[model samples]
Target: MLIRDYAEIFPEWVKLAKVACVIPVSSVPAERGFSLQNRIKTAQRSRLGEGRVTRRMHIASSRDTLDTFDFNSAAARFTAAKYRKK
Candidate 1:
């Protein structure tokens, strides 16, 4: 609000403030991602490739919304794809 009110008088400062505002205020998000990766890549599953790990991470992160997703359609598409492994 202060930045918007004095934007005209402090154009450069306002620009700096806008950029600073986008900078993360904490490292918790990054730490959480790393922690999730650690949990997904346990010693027993350490051989999993990067692509598989990434897909697992995406699934784990979005698990909260899985109930609303169309799993039937996704399953159909997966089975209909010719390139998919048996």
Candidate 2:
């Protein structure tokens, strides 16, 4: 941390530090979904059910920034599926 007076003297350095801070400290989030598949798909979960566990994987492993699914389209598909079957 710099004193307010010192910060005026080193404005460029402060800007550089701000840019560097944006860089990720660790790259874990990039590979999180794949890395966590085994953890989420435990031996007990795998044997008890197949489709049940798979349905929840996307929610469990997806990045926090990407959760805006279009439920309207999914609901439309659900309605259309029944008519197509007949």
Candidate 3:
């Protein structure tokens, strides 16, 4: 009723309010993203470019076992591919 009443006086606000109300109140996913951003956008690397940040964020977000990941096999595969005759 209040929204309908405001529709005439503030049509733009009513539309925006309706949209805002439909959004989920929980911020768990957004908070996780914020934490990831903080980890990647450190004070030391403040000037890191957007493309680099996006790439690193993608890398960071994709994997679950990064700490124990096998770099040797990955490196070997990369070297083999890089040296493969194209």
Candidate 4:
């Protein structure tokens, strides 16, 4: 019933709703943590203890900066600095 009358009775509301949109955000960091765990616990190194594995995983994930680290620029800058020091 509500669905059928949504456009007729709530015409203004529908128009306002149509003009706006919604988006969902999520924590990609948490997903990266799980991925790190799997990679760390692979066949050859499956004997790792839970606590040590969790700590290592957390450190690795936390170091993954979303911005601020540009590998190419950093490498160029490092090379330039080293060359100047000579």
Tens digits of per-residue lDDT for model 4, 14-81: 77665653432676867877788999888988898999898888767667685766899879999999
Candidate 1 per-residue lDDT, tens place, 38-68, comes to 9999999999999999999998998667679
Provide the TM-score for each candidate, comma-separated: 0.66, 0.36, 0.52, 0.38
The candidate 1 region of ten consecutive residues with least summed lDDT is 77-86
TM-score, cand. 3: 0.52
Which of the predicted structures, 1 or 4, would earn the higher lDDT when compared with the native? Answer: 1
Error of 3 at 4 (Å): 22
Each candidate structure's count of clashing pairs? 0, 0, 0, 0
The lDDT for every candidate, in the order shown, is: 0.91, 0.72, 0.89, 0.78
Off by over 4 Å in 1: 1-15, 64-66, 83-86
Reference-based TM-score, model 1: 0.66
Off by over 4 Å in 2: 1-34, 48-67
Residue-level lDDT for 1 in candidate 3: 64
lDDT digits (tens) for residues 1-86 of candidate 2: 74345578999888877788799988887677557666777777767465656666676756444367777887999999989999
Q: What's the lDDT of the predicted structure labeled candidate 4?
A: 0.78
Please, what are the lDDT tens digits per residue for candidate 3 over residues 1-86?
64877789888898898998999899998999889988999999999999998889999998859688899999999999989965
Query: What's the true lDDT of residue 65 in model 3?
Result: 95
